[model samples]
Target: MDQAAAGMQGAHRAPVCYRHPDRETGVRCTRCERPICPECMVSASVGFQCPACVRGGSDTGPAPAASRPRTIAGGTVTADPRLLTKVLIGVNLAVFLAQLAVGSSLTDRFELIGQAQFSLFSPVQGVAEGQYYRLLTAMFLHSPTNYTHILFNMLSLWWIGGPLEAALGRARYLALYFVSGLAGSALTYMVADPRLPSLGASGAIFGLFGATGVLMRRLNYDLRPLVALLVINLIITFTPGFNISWEAHIGGLVAGVAVGYAMVHAPRERRTVIQYGACAVVLAVVVVLTLVRTAQLT
Candidate 1:
């Protein structure tokens, strides 16, 4: 017979209980291989056990032990609603609709309502002036004259933003979007015209593209489609009569790449410091360049 069977047979042969070796017990504890008298035994799911063993086992071990709570990254986790993308889209659409409500022709409306040279689009100039907010506000404003401006940007966001938002969570995604947008605007201000008003989410969208590229590379995902799409869009940006901000597009794209490299490609343990520092450095350089260009223009 097997050892377990032999043990059981020997246990049955003894009139004394298995647990209470000193006493002539008549019952066995089902789980722990112990004996008890009839007065100490209790019925359980599997068989009979000493009342004390059952109670103590339930408290001390797996018998009725508290379940282990599940963990994500070694802590209890909660789901995060994707709020940043929705808020960004809402703000852009709201601004577009507001532009429509104003009584201006399409190109003129976009120039005025979107963002343009302070003299052309607004009544102010210089960074210190209240018009300085235009550096940021412009990103939320799109060309009301062209449907493609909004369509392409929003589509890019849908495709690229969803995955990034899922990976980075809402806060980091939002920060990347705004910082990239500002980087794009700074590039345009330096290269194009600071006094000239320009506005669109294309810069931020380009940043998303950059981030997507990094994500693909790090995750070993297929990148051919993304590269193809980027090439096609850039071609469209440079096409004659497109009236697109190629400068902003390039700037945001570069910023996104830099940020993504720091965030997604860096070793996990070093990412937090490296990512924040890289983004900050990029923003500072853009700001300084914009300031110098603006000074020269004035």
Candidate 2:
């Protein structure tokens, strides 16, 4: 009988507390699985244990879980590190160099290579004349006669694109850029001297400004500097001695603002659908106007 009692005592030994390694524990915390001494333990409805164990117990507990910290306004937050503006600049520079390589003058090569849907070399023109690839080719062409055409456009893009791209993300910003450019081209085709071949990214850059304006307004951000810069550029646009596609600029600006409003200001859940729909609607309108004007000219 004495041997059996000693064996039972050894088998029934209490667990050691993790917090107080040297002390024996009578209960355990359900959440953390740490043992607790009776003095450190809390009176849980189910059993005696540590304060942490009692707090975490599931039996109609009065002590609630700790509250999470809230984000405060003006608090510094990390931004995404992607550099979309630099990538776009690199692409434009690469294309410009390629144009220079193809011909002695960058101007001459750009004239031949730039997107002119109605131009003699255009694949779409060939297709209409019964030939097919000009639809895609038209997107690459830049103005052959004017160096400032691409220079100013690129400068504007460098200025406004970095911040906007960082805010909107790469894919959305790129879509806006391309759509705005296409809108500008469509406007130029409709209203300007079509016989005078035109190419450049100014329309898209202008669109960036428009989008920036809308985003600033929506976010309650100050846009005084941006507005001032835009005004100075506009004055330059109208000045004599420089050939500027004012039509393209205006078209791109309108499209950009519309896109920005839809994408940035609209509710988050519906943003994608609304942004794409807005772009499509604007493009359709521009295309219709261009077709109507073309019909009138012919």
Candidate 3:
């Protein structure tokens, strides 16, 4: 009897996730009571529930529309989490290819500049000349002569963007990306020499880095890896020979962290309002900075 009891006790082990059999998880679906890994879990009104329960309806019947599943940022959960990231990458690549085929034509017109003419005959152009579209267009461009520039930026985007898109969902992720990029542009316009041409996706990538850090913190994940990577990037940004735009990087990171916090930490009862309201506040700041800089340059 004693031996049998000991064997039974030894056999009783913590449950592994039903979907991902290799992953051990203490968390169980509130509806179905099956173990679930983080990837298989869905945010629920009460406790985390397995995706099956979330999709198949509760024991009482289909989950009401009011109780529909949502992402951490209150965005609707998507079937293809990385779709937006892929599209953004595609757009960047297409723009880059156009830059290559068209020589300096595309870049000269679109690259961010405060106020400058590339040559004596070139019509005076830039943000100060009312070409504010440069702020948005510049982010889709890179040094046409440097293949490595776009290569590195695209790789970083894939590495950081896909997971972020999954966590925040398409709408929230898109807003974060564009706002972060714009924040970088606004700061570059404000601080960097307006006459110098500036272009790259590093600012947006750095923004993703900041948001990823915030998201990891929110989920209680180990942050050492992200911190180390960010440290390296910062070093590259500030290193004397790199010629990187520290202003853009800093601006994007700060904006990303701020927006990411609002997305993850907002009250459940008012998540959408708080999340979008935070984005609006950031945009307002960006607008103020742009106007101040334009006034200085013009």
Query: Candidate 2 clashing pairs?
Result: 41-49, 42-49, 114-141, 115-138, 115-141, 123-134, 124-134, 126-131, 127-130, 127-131
> Each prediction's Cα lDDT score?
0.66, 0.61, 0.85
Where model 3 places Cα greater than 4 Å from the true spot, the runs are: 1-41, 56-67
Q: Which is better, 1 or 3, measured by lDDT?
A: 3
TM-score of each: 0.67, 0.62, 0.87
Candidate that beats the other on TM-score, 1 or 2, i.e. the better one = 1
* Model 2 TM-score (2 dp): 0.62
184-234 per-residue lDDT for model 3 (tens digits) = 999999999988889999888888999999988876666899999999989
Clashing pairs in 1: 19-34, 19-35, 115-197, 115-198, 116-196, 116-197, 117-195, 117-196, 117-197
TM-score of 3: 0.87
lDDT of 2 by residue, 74-179 (tens): 0111134136677777777677667666753444323312223543553322212311122223334555445665676678778789667755666677788888
